[model samples]
Target chain A: MNTYDLIIVGAGPGGSVAAKIAAEKGLKTVFFERGRKPGEKNSSGCGLGPRMFRDFPEMMKKLTPEKCHSMRAGVAARNYFVNKDDIVAGYIMARPTESVSYEPAKSWITMNVYRSEFDPWIAEFATDAGAELKTSTLIIDLLKENGKVSGVIDDKGEKYKAPIVIGADGAVSTVAQKSGLRSKWSQNQVTLTLQYDFQAPSEKIDDIMGDETLAVWWGSNFPASYQVFFNDGFHQGLGNWMTWWDKTPLFYLNRVVNLKYYQRLLKILDAKPRELQAHLLPWLDYPYNTYTDGIILIGDAGGFPCPLEAEGIYPAMVTGKIAAEVAAEAVSSGDFSKESLKKFDEGWKKTSIGEEFEAGAELWNIWKALPFSPKETMSWFVPMIMEILGGIFDWSQPHGKRVRQIISHVKSYMPKATPFIMKNVFPLVAKIFEDDLDKIMDPKKIMKVLPKLLDMLPQKKKRRGSQEK
Target chain B: MKIELEGLTKRIPGTGEFISINSLKCNNCDRCLFVCVMNLWRKKEGKIYLAEDYQSKCLECAACFQVCDAGAIMFKYPAGGTGIVIEKG
Candidate 1:
């Protein structure tokens, strides 16, 4: 048995980060990668969020000009909403930096990185920190001692012993499966993604994508949303909910790539895919199991992928650090039990990673659980919501009539209009807008609109009479 | 139309066949068909099966194993360097 203070499976961001931290703490750590190289089997074109710089500044020093593309500070959040025919339905561009009410100092800056270059770099950081990395070593299962995880066994039937093991083995983690810590993710919990890496000239990518801004497209025709990030070239991909498919992702990909909108962009970049990559990543609705006795799961294996954007690099690194912090304490105390590792669970939740996942889950459920299928949700609900919000500030309509129009629209679309109106929507709206309502109710604001409101009263009464009849 | 992934080859030979579905436990919910990006799974004669020896096209994301509620899917990654590899990744 090869023994170490800690053993980590999978040399992706999670395992590498854990190894770096543990080794920094003077704990002997060994991390294993199944691929011939650290990132040989990993996904590419990840967006490392602002939290990456905040949490791991040392890792930032490791980023290279070739491996990473530092997104600009002024890059705004831009969303292009496409309809069934690939027509742009609505566009939203918000410059967080320009918002007076928003604090620019706390804004997030995203970095685009290819895992092939990024993973090997991070793994090298761990090695430089005195951690041992065994490449091309496939960890098949966890080694158990009296029903508690003691270490992991690689493909050659060789067992490596450690007081603790961290499973960072991406989505299909063998350690999580074999230890029975978690065997499989439900369809709803994970998503299937397929991405194409296009090799374009740096000048072309900059010209087409505005140098630093990232762009996202949401449409009914797309299996899921599509994203484009700039690396040396362009990384464009689509991911759909695992169980929401009417056709295979490939079918959707073919359709999306040929769309007029995509075709125009492709033309600009002279789109020729250098490679195609596919992956399964968790989109945890809420926090799921991540830690166990003598073993902790991090990154995709632990279901820490950010829910809203399905971005995994930040959560993986953040949780990796948190796990290492907890593991270092556990090793120092000579306690490798579940109770000792529970601190990772509590500690991670309090961090930005936990907050992002929790908030992302709420946003996902609101979009997913709407009383419509995925297609309808995008085609009908999203555009309608955007239009309604757009109408709120439409100066052409009287404010009073606009309010009535918004109420009518809500009632028309809701599945059970009466109960939804009476039980939830009305009370929540009233509570939220109570102060604004008092201002609007002022005789001054209403005086100008009284004639317009009174003129509409007969029509409203006639409509009510028909309903009652 | 199937998009030709030129220069695409198995990372290692004969590894894609490791994942399979057990017929006894599968209730033919067609979840596998929905989840597989390669279109490798299909329902035939009221039974579900892989449409072809198509695992080489698999991304090996384990969506099939995870999505199958019937516990009918048996998933194991192909031997190291034997399945798909994203060279640019």
Candidate 2:
């Protein structure tokens, strides 16, 4: 039997960072990796958020060479919203100087890295800082004694004891399963993601990525959006609500991959599609049970990925550090009960994880409201907007014809858009976007919205039904 | 047009069976079939059955078990250390 102060499972960012901090605090920590080496399980997401450097300055030293280069001189970026035809309907170009952060040092906002390289580097970094690292060891179960977790049992039946255990495992976490924390995540709580990695030479990669750190293509005509990020190569993928699977996720990926617009983008890059990767990400819309007596869960295991972007690294590492800090305090006080571990939850809530999760949920609520199937809002709305404006301003059409076109189209589209706008869009705007609706509300705005509101009102027949009843 | 691609290559390395559907408990609503991205579950003669020999394709996301409200789906990790190993993660 081997014992330590804390045993962390999974060598991804969360577990490795926890191991490092606990060891740095002289807690005699040990972390286990199921893979042969850290980062061997190559789950690729675009980058580290600015909060990563803010929360753990030490990670500044661990940035991959590519990340460092991107950070030193931020990459140009473009986001595109395309229709089914793959014609770009919306686009935004971003420079590093346009980053959202007020802190100049954090201005890069996010630096992309390949998880295969980054995860391994961080795990070795933790080992270098005194955390014992065990690789290729699959933890079979959490060892329990007196109704509390005391340690873990490996697949080989090897037992290692510790006062605290952190389930930093990815989405399919064994620790969460064996500890009676969760059996499975519901479809709404997780997103199924599938991506194709295109391996391109450095010069080619740079040329393809020129003036763009990330490019996104999406439209209501498609089942979901697609994103491509450039690092050592191009990683393009789609993630959609698990519940939305009319067909397998790969079916949608196939559609996107074969789309003319996507093919053109690849042609421009002249990149070779190397591998197809898939992973499940937990998108916790609300705070979840993350800690129990003598145990804590972080990262995807805790369902800590961002709801908005599905970005996991920053939140995982943030929660990992918080878990370690709380565990250290518990160890110093000689208390490792659920009461003490609850501090891990409270500590993390105080950090950006809580706020980011809230934001993700807010945005997701509106996003999920988009017509799931048999409706194409973007395809219809964009052209209609242009037509309406053209009718009013384009001047090519006669005034009477333009008025008729605008009125007829508005009348037809209003009914369909009304339900979504009133049901999903309005509540979102009222609750999340508008803090002072009274002040924001003007006579003109009300007049503008009134026709749609009137159109949404119950029809005469429906009102007659109500009267009859 | 179809885009040809390879499925997951690695295994979870387990002798223990991971997913089982209790036919007796299932209503054969086929919800599991629709939810499983791996196409592992199917309905035949109004009864749900898993595909023969496609268990290796399971991502183990448990979407089937989660969507099965009838408690017919039993999902556990393949015996510790045996199941899908994401070699490339």
Candidate 3:
């Protein structure tokens, strides 16, 4: 038996981060990777969310330009919601807003990174912290001692012993299965997405998708997809709920790439197919069975991917650190009971994971449980929004028409967006886009429509207004 | 403008064996067919089966295993260093 104080399966963000923290705490740690290198078998093109820098404040200063090239591309949160026919329905350009805490988080929505380069870069920290990394090994299952997890067994049937094991083997986690956490995620809990990596000159990517910005496409016909521009390449990824797909993702990808929107982008970049791959993500909400005796699941294995955007790296790293601290305490105390490991659960609650995942779950469910399917919501929302914006912005439309467009669609959006509307958020958005409408706010026209808008309000408010009249 | 899926979906040998359907458990709901990103699950003569070149075509994300209600599909990541290498995800 190969014995270590801690055993970690998968060299992903979660596992590697755990290894680093555990080793730094003076516990002997060994992490396994299925790839020949740290991240070759792993996926690439990830957005290390703002929380990463917030948590590891020293990480920014630690990265020497020579150490990591992928990260030097800088940070951006320029998001685009693309509609059917590849039209951009909405665009959000990120800049500093009100902030006293975590200043980098203001402009840095996410730092785009290629896992092939980024994973190895992070994993090196674990090794430098005195953790051992075994590459090209798969921990097929968890080893048990009297119904308690003792460690993991690799594919060749070699058993490694430890008092604690962190299951970071991703969404399709083997440790999760053998430990009886789950056989696999159900259709509702996980989404499978396919990505096409198109390699291009660095200049080409910067010229097109903007070196810093990443775009996501959502539509009735196309489903959910993204184009993320990195240093040497960009990834066009397509995805949907696992159970709702009536056809393969490839079926829709073929149709989408044919549209003029993508054609012009591809032709300009002169991109070539570098790799086609897919990833499974735990999406809907968080998982209940994330921790047990002598075992803790982190990352997608623990169902920690973000509900809104499906980003896993941040939650994974956060949980990984918390789990490692709990693991170290357990090993030192010789108490590997589930109660002792509850710290992993309690610790993440104090961090941004709970706030992010909880709010994100509500926002995500609004899309999933909408009056329309995810596909229909995209089609319904985008065109309506685009028409209203076009009505207001385009000079071709008469002022009356723009006002009519705004009033007509006002009924569609107000109910859906109001409850969670941040203070001034809606008004700012309305103000920014309604400049043309502000000019055309004819009082007589407002008075005519105002009565109808007041009627749409509750009868009690209308009665109060009628008394004033 | 037109992207070809044929040349894009690539794979190394041996990982296709990672996912197999258990005969007795299979109810043939064909759910796997709908969920597969690569469309590697095919129906031939009243049976749902892994396509012949599944090893080459399968991206190995295991959407099939997730959606299968009958617990018929068995999936594992292939032995270390022998499966699909995701360049960017």
Candidate 4:
């Protein structure tokens, strides 16, 4: 049996961060990943926030020029069609500031990265800090001794022992399950999202997207939830909710609806789709306890993926760092019990995760209730929310001012005509401030309850297929 | 050749789940090939191909299939005793 002070499963942002922090603190940390390399199995339209640079300054210092790609500004555009053939588009632009510098084309600077390049770059920081990384290895089970998690068992029946185990294995977390930290997630608690990365010629991309701004297209035709993101040059990623697939018999029908919408977009840009890739993203909605005796879950394993934006990289890294802090404290104390690890859970909820989810859940519910047309939602609701937030709160302000502004904005939006926002929104937002305000001050509560309210809203029936095996 | 698209929809090689591809809707953009961490997509001449060459390397993250825009890349859990077999280090 191999032993270590801490063992982290999965080498995505979460696992790697945890390993780096633990190793830097002089703990014997060993990280395991099933992928051939750190970022090999990971993919995302990631927005690496500035706060990450503040938290992990050392890791940032290690970033080589090849590893970082910069974006200048962020634009949210909507394509509205008068008919199946004729479409009009509009956009909203925002400049990045000191606090929110990661938006595309911001003067403060933000970078877009290929996970394949980014994950290993960060993992190297951990290895340099003396953490052992085991790649191409699958962790099959949790070694439970006397009803407590002792370590992990790999497929080869080799048991690696550790005082603590951190599950950062992503949304479909094997470590979380094997360690008995969480039950199988409910569909409602998860959002199945699919995205596409289209490769185009650089000049074509520059002509279509222009220079260095991230462009987002919302409310095209698929649903109120559709978004297409343009990154770097020639790379565009589009995503839509998968729940809609249940309503129609033909899976491709959903794609057709999206494609038709994009066809109009293609005309606008005079560009064609070049390599299209799709993926299902598990967005966490409901809160699940993410810690157990000798075990803790971080990143997607803890359901920390931002439910609204589907952004996980920053939060994953943040949570991983927090988890490592807790693990270090536990290891120094020579104890790895649920009670010892409770600080991680408590600390996480106190941070941005709780508030972000609350806001995301509320936003999801309101969006779900809006008519299925993406055009209407994007044209009216999405911008309305952003404008409202921009008006009430300034992202460049201090944390206190931001919180106050968020509260004021929520109060204002609560009475709006959108029943989903009015009914499900305020209560969820209130929850974020009501109980956890001292520990965490996030405006995300308003976003959490929207889905449940949407479920209550009368909607169309779904067609069943020969049930998926 | 009589081709039942429905038959192709059943069973995702290793896992006991049915994965299907709407071949008619497939645009062959090859996005899944780029996103697949295992390099499961191969290019034959001008067309895109899906192979299991590095299938054993798949962590089942589903990033490739999730990023397929045309619904062309379908996944069926591999049959019993077949698919990416992972080993411990």
* Highest DockQ model number: 3
Candidate 1 local lDDT, residue A111: 64
Superposition-based RMSD of candidate 4 using all C-alpha atoms, in angstroms: 14.7
Q: What value does the lDDT take at residue A35 in candidate 2?
A: 64
**How do these models rank on TM-score, best leading?**
3, 2, 1, 4
| Candidate that scores best on lDDT | 3
Ranked by DockQ, the better of candidates 1 and 2 is 1
> How do the residues A102-216 of candidate 3 rate in per-residue lDDT, one tens digit apiece?
7566665667777877788888889999999998798888788898888888888888999888999888888888888788777788777777888788877676556465765
TM-score of chain A as modeled in candidate 1: 0.81
The C-alpha RMSD of each candidate to the native structure, in angstroms, is 6.9, 7.7, 7.3, 14.7
Candidate 4's TM-score reads 0.65
Please list all clashing residue pairs in model 3, or write none if there are none.
Answer: A44-B89
Per model, the share of native interface contacts recovered reads 0.55, 0.31, 0.78, 0.04
Tens-place lDDT digits, model 4, residues A1-469: 7999999988888888899889989889999876567765555545565566666676775666555442222342333322222233334544454565342324433455556667878888889889999986778678878887788987657789997899988776777667766544553554444333333444555666553345444443444333333343223433344334323212322343345445655556554433222334556564577887888888888877776655777788888989999999998998887888899878877777766765666655654545344544433555455544454545577645565455444454443434554455554565646654424433355345654454443333354584767
lDDT to native, each model: 0.72, 0.70, 0.74, 0.59
Put down candidate 1 lDDT per residue, A1-469, tens digits, no spaces. Answer: 6899999988998889999999999999999987778877987436666667666776784577755452333255567777767776676765446443332224534566667677888888899999999987778778888887788887778899998988899888887888677778776777788877777776776676663456666666775554546555556677766877777777777776776777787788776767777788777866567777888889889988776666788788888889998989988998988888899899889998777654554545544543214465666655566666666787777666676676566544544433333443433344445444344354445445644554454344333346653
Alpha-carbon error at A282 in model 4, in Å?
A: 3.7
Is candidate 3 or 4 superior in TM-score? 3
